[model samples]
Target: MEPPRDAKLLDPTTQPARIRAMYTDPDFVRRGLGRAILARCEGAARAAGFRSVEMMATLAGEPLYQACGYAAIAPVRSAPVEGVTVPLIRMGKWL
Candidate 1:
């Protein structure tokens, strides 16, 4: 059966939506590639008419994103992974 429209994980009203997955490759990350990528994404979101953008962050990534203006909106919860319950932060920024 097909999933309900709203059941899709993304926000539909966020037109021209963009998704990015970033990591600091040893050669790229330490030199500020991640920050540059985030800045580009935010600019693209604004140009696309998105009022905001959202991201889920692992504990290690939280500080970086926060420093770049993303704010925590809520704490993430889910069933255990590998017998260890993990937590994540739901973060967002206005474009």
Candidate 2:
């Protein structure tokens, strides 16, 4: 069974590893699941001796990541999703 929320730690193909495919079930959002998942991902990175972690954030998720200590690393960028376009921000945090 899937957990109430989810986060994935991407292997470090680049200098600092990246996080991708993170999400919380709508009903469970803001109830700490997302934070817990983010913490788990960071913990794993630290355990693996990584210096930092990075992720691309959808507009809706930017604030949450900011609260988790991720800083915007670049200007907002747009990408197509489904049939519409949305903004994304690149963010990074030291482990």
Per-prediction TM-score to the true structure, in the order listed: 0.69, 0.77
Error of 2 at 78 (Å): 4.9
Task: Quote the lDDT for 1 in model 1.
Answer: 33
Candidate 2 residue pairs that clash: none
Q: Model 1 scores what on Cα lDDT?
A: 0.73
Kindly report which residue stretches of model 2 are placed more than 4 angstroms away from their true locations once superposed.
1-14, 76-83
lDDT per residue (tens digit) for residues 1-95 in model 2 = 33353356545545676788899888888799989989999998888878899998988889999999999998675555555666788999987
Which 10 consecutive residues of model 2 have the lowest summed lDDT? 1-10
Estimate every model's Cα lDDT from 0 to 1.
0.73, 0.83
1-95: candidate 1 lDDT, tens digit per residue = 33444544545365334444566776665578789888988887777667888877767789989999988879986457567766778788776
| Pairs in clash, predicted candidate 1 | none
Clashes of each: 0, 0
